[model samples]
Target chain A: MRLSSGDSIFYDLFTAAALNLRDGVRVLSEALAPDADRAALVPRLKDIEHAGDEHTHDIVRRVNSGAKTPFHRDDIYRLAGGIDDVLDDVEAALDLMVLYRIKEMPTGIAAVVDVLDRAADLTAEAMPRLRTANELTKYWIEINRLENEADQTYRRLLAHIFSGEYDALTVHKLKDVIEILESAVDGFERVANIVEQIALKQ
Target chain B: MRLSSGDSIFYDLFTAAALNLRDGVRVLSEALAPDADRAALVPRLKDIEHAGDEHTHDIVRRVNSGAKTPFHRDDIYRLAGGIDDVLDDVEAALDLMVLYRIKEMPTGIAAVVDVLDRAADLTAEAMPRLRTANELTKYWIEINRLENEADQTYRRLLAHIFSGEYDALTVHKLKDVIEILESAVDGFERVANIVEQIALKQ
Candidate 1:
């Protein structure tokens, strides 16, 4: 697939967004460490999230300027928005952790973060391939599988929270964080789904 | 602003999706009623959700077949998916109610449902204007305001639930349902957001 200059720019933006997502999820996983500095890590996650926002804005701006898009204009917008959403949820989870003053990290939180980090890595790797639609199926499939694992982990965490194991306040604090983590995973799946749809259309 | 034949089909799909959303939210609100038959309402909600899914699928299939879409292809896909997502969450909320066997409805539940019903109605009213992009600013703005109201209601409900007002199990059940209702509202905002983006690009 011969790429035009505008297509090259779109690919660059998508790649940048993916790398930002991967870095953001990595920070998120690290922040979940039991001994990690919650205060410091959150600001870094915010920077990554802001970068994601800029990338999404850039893509939308380019699309609006009537640049010749490599894929359907709508796919480019969705792909950019979808990638931004994953980062947004990542930032939200970290912010909630800080707001809730969660001290100890739950084992299940680490598990879900691990899945999200891998999904982020997969997404970053898959973004460039949007041009060629090459070998994208495995990326979307893996993301879907990771999301299912995250779902199961989320349910288990919910059950654990409500099993009289934690105080009401603790449950209240933990529930929002866990749900946002699950939403981040779901956001990744949405990005992968969009990629798959683009591939199928191609 | 004249729409071609193919454009009319896209409008019809969006309208149908919006109507399905309105009906699904209505049923969801009714199911939350204290005297309602939860089991029967579940299947009916399921049917509405299925209808939403089919409409979304139809839009995607049409887009895939190279039909001339009124908006950007990505916007159409996002709009259809966003509308379908609200119904999906509505169904999820009802299913959780049944799964958790929540016999009593909280007062806050009805308030959020009322907001969602209006949001859904607003969405149906806005879909036709995709052709002209007429008066959509008000639509998106109103949806955003409704979402903000829903957010305040959600936080208040959360505070009430965690104030030792309900048992831990009850809190667990209500939390998921309320969150999904909030999510449905957010989903509507997303649809409006996509519409606004499309209008801007025009």
Candidate 2:
């Protein structure tokens, strides 16, 4: 079960990707601020997403190139793909907000984003733990709990949007944004589940 | 490399799921018809979705029970999950349409759904081929092409919705429906890709 130096690099790449997600979530929070310049921030988040893709590609390339790894190759592919899914949803949420020129967001959005921010932190902290598969139960459990919180926040946010407060067009645009945010939170839970699966196999 | 009788059940389960998808899409098409009864059709599609979930759970149970599989266990997990994803999106699209009580769908919607219909048919046709891993390249290629077509139809549909033809509220509702349809098409592509990966590994 000994891993080569090459295998050790997997931990570094995963940690890099997780840390990048933390940065992406932080910028997303700023973009949601009342006075934030969304137009400019969109590109910044897009850049983070692009970086995330490279991280994913690097992981996949390692697996595809027939390198030996610590865990099942398919698990690596799924884990990398899961992380990319979260970043894609996060970037899309910001991009859509700008595309629809949506200015007024429901207050409940912050609750969901706060959960995502915490998930990002937890994911990043747990990446290195993949090497040992140690003390990882809490990470997945907390992510699942946060996802439940997000689901409630998302429901309230939708109710707020559909309360006939905003015009029809605004409701349409806001719903699009909120649904993607919910997907992003779900993506975190999906990633955590993959981590748990990989741990169990060990 | 020989499969046991228990292993053969996988093909039957997959074929059953794919055939069920065909039935689901046909009902969806019917529900989209101008003269059709969406209220009645919604329950039918819901039934189809529930059936799909059972198929997925059955496949997972077989794998968890340590039964031999025709392909890698993880690939089995992913393929089942991918198929379930498509059904969920398809059901969601139909459900949202009924929830919004949309009476006037754009002509372009039929084009998008048409692609989905075709993709579902192709997928259903390909499931049995998993046993021999034969003739699947065309299946995946056609699905990828159809997805591209779906993307174009979706963009045009969005443009038409935003073209000031309908009121703001109507645009919101139409966009929601169209987005889910697009996701369903993408889900098909994902399933196709997993099939391709499994085929290549074999």
Candidate 3:
């Protein structure tokens, strides 16, 4: 789909923001446990969260200021907020991983990371199609599929966590981590909700 | 606070929903472990959730119908959805309770119930005054205060859950319940976020 210069700019900016957030999750996932750079990880995670917030503001400011745009201003704003929420939850997982001094992120944690990564990817893929509302259906279906898959993955991961080598304290800490990751997918689900709602309106 | 006819109707419908859900929770809280009337209880709880979805549609339909409204329609829609999300979580919690044969409500569960009750009150309180932008801040503040209190209560309750309790299975079951209760506030917090965001626009 061809885009106006302004719309293209917003798309580029939002895509970059989404990529930063997804990349941040990648970094944290690789260093699931307390890393040697544990002290530095806090600020790194904060930077990721801050970038998410900044991108949120950037998107909203554009929506508020733009007289004309490709699609519903409100829909765009919601999509941006949904993407921002994913980062917030991912950063939250990182925060808990650090705060609890979790020595290791049990083997079960990867499912969440995988779900989040896929959700982020789905959102990234859906961005260019935002201006072409009809094409959103393809992306929307895939996003919905990923969110459903995330739900299954979350249920399995929780069962794994509970059935494994974690004590109550560890279970408590691990649940917090998994909850955040699961929540990121829920955030993605929220984005899917907004997209689906927008599609309904269209 | 003189009401438009539509606002009046919306208020009454929402009030009935709040009462039904509140009473439903009361029933679940008081019932015994084995004889909790699953057939009756499940559908009644579902009624609350279904009511919430209906209320969501009502708000959106009212907005779409060109009703003269005070606050942002989408914000109201989001706020209503958020409240419903809390009830949805509550219902989900009850499902898990029944599935797990959770016999007793923990002492800490009261805090979340209190929060849900207050959120209902706040939403009810906010509705009439929503036609008057002058009064939004107070309503917004109440939601924020309740949400903040819910957060602290959740932390304290979880800490207590970990520090106290019956056994590993008990802790496991209890922790799951506590998290569900706590995430209900997360739903309320989202409501508050939408409310505050709307307030900022005003």
Candidate 4:
């Protein structure tokens, strides 16, 4: 997809935001590892999230400056905001893990992180094509599917938590972490949905 | 604020959505009552949520038709989606209560519902001003503050739940309901944020 001169900056911003999301989720996956070091990994995750915030601010500044954007200015704003949301939730999940002083990851946390990793990868791959709105249908469809899978996983994990397998406190801690991870996956779906909306308009 | 012809439909849709959100949360509050009849209230809440879905669809249809919108079209879409999200989370919370066959509401559910009710009223009152962007700073600021309150309540509720006050199963069920209610409040905050963003851009 060939980008016009005016649209190139948006493409750059979106791509950077997507790559930042990928990095943030990678850190998240590491944080959910069985032997993960919360103290060490959390600061690194925060850095990635901070980087995502900077990219989001750049996109928002561009939109607010009344520049000629490739798509509707609001879509660009939403896309940036949605990507930032994914990173924010990633950071939140990691922070919760640290705050709760959870020594062990829940059984389903890894699966949720795996889905987020794929969603982030797909989002990065799909973002550059936003200039032309090309092949976005598959991107969004796959994202939607992954989100559904994440939802099921979330429900199953909740059931497991409540199934008398763990004490009330442990269940509480794990639930907090799982819900944040679920929100991150949902955040990715929101970005995909926004991209699909923009593509349809284009 | 007198609405221009091009903006009137949007105002109508936004007002209807805000009202629907109010109604949905009202029902949600009732559902959290100690002697509530889940069977009776769930259907009514679902009706209110369905009505919200209709209003949201109307907004999207209008935007998709390239009709002249009062604000940026993307803002309209996001505002509609954010409003619908509040109602959807309300409905989901109610559904979870029924599905979990929860006999008692959590301690903090009422507090969260009160905040949501106030937030909904503020949002409804603010929708008309969206045309002129009048008096909106207070609206979003108050909503943000309410969201903060909801967050504190959520944390406190979690602490209470995990403080060995309830059995594992009961805590799990209550936590699910509380989280969805929290999300509804957050959804309201998202709407307020979008409104603030639109107001600033204007």
Off by over 4 Å in 2: A1-4, A35-47, A64-66, A72-75, A107-122, A129-164, A189-202, B1-102, B117-135, B148-180
Question: Candidate 1 — which residues are off by over 4 angstroms?
Answer: A1-17, A33-85, A193-202, B1-30, B35-44, B67-83, B98-101, B107-202
Candidate 1, residues A1-202, lDDT tens digits: the string is: 2344746788878898899889999998888999989899987998888888888898899899988887899989888888888888888888888888899867777789789878988998998888788889889889889998888788778767766677878878888898888898899999998999888878
lDDT of each: 0.85, 0.87, 0.69, 0.86
RMSD of 1: 7.2
Candidate 3 lDDT over B110-190, as tens digits, reads 766777677666655555444344576776677778888888888887677677556675678777777887787677567
Candidate 1 vs candidate 4, DockQ winner:
4
Q: How many clashing residue pairs appear in each of the predictions shown?
A: 1, 0, 0, 0
Model 3: residues >4 Å from true position, as ranges?
A: A1-4, A20-85, A91-111, A141-145, A163-165, A192-202, B1-12, B30-48, B65-79, B96-103, B106-202
> What ranking of all candidate models by lDDT puts the best one first?
2, 4, 1, 3
Model 2 lDDT tens row, B1-202: 2333768889888888888888888888887777778889888898999999999999999999999898999999999999998888888888898899999689877898799889989999999899899999999999999998998788678767866689987887888888888898999999999999999888
Predicted model with the maximum lDDT: 2
Candidate achieving higher DockQ, 3 or 4: 4
Decreasing DockQ order of the candidates: 2, 4, 1, 3
TM-score of the first chain in candidate 2 relative to the native first chain: 0.96
Worst 10 residues of 3 chain B by lDDT: B26-35
Error of model 2, residue B64, in angstroms: 14
Model 1 TM-score on a 0 to 1 scale: 0.63
Best by TM-score: 2
TM-score winner, 1 or 4: 4
Model 4, range B98-179, lDDT digits (tens) per residue?
A: 7667888766667887898899899999998887889999999999999999999999899988999787779778887898
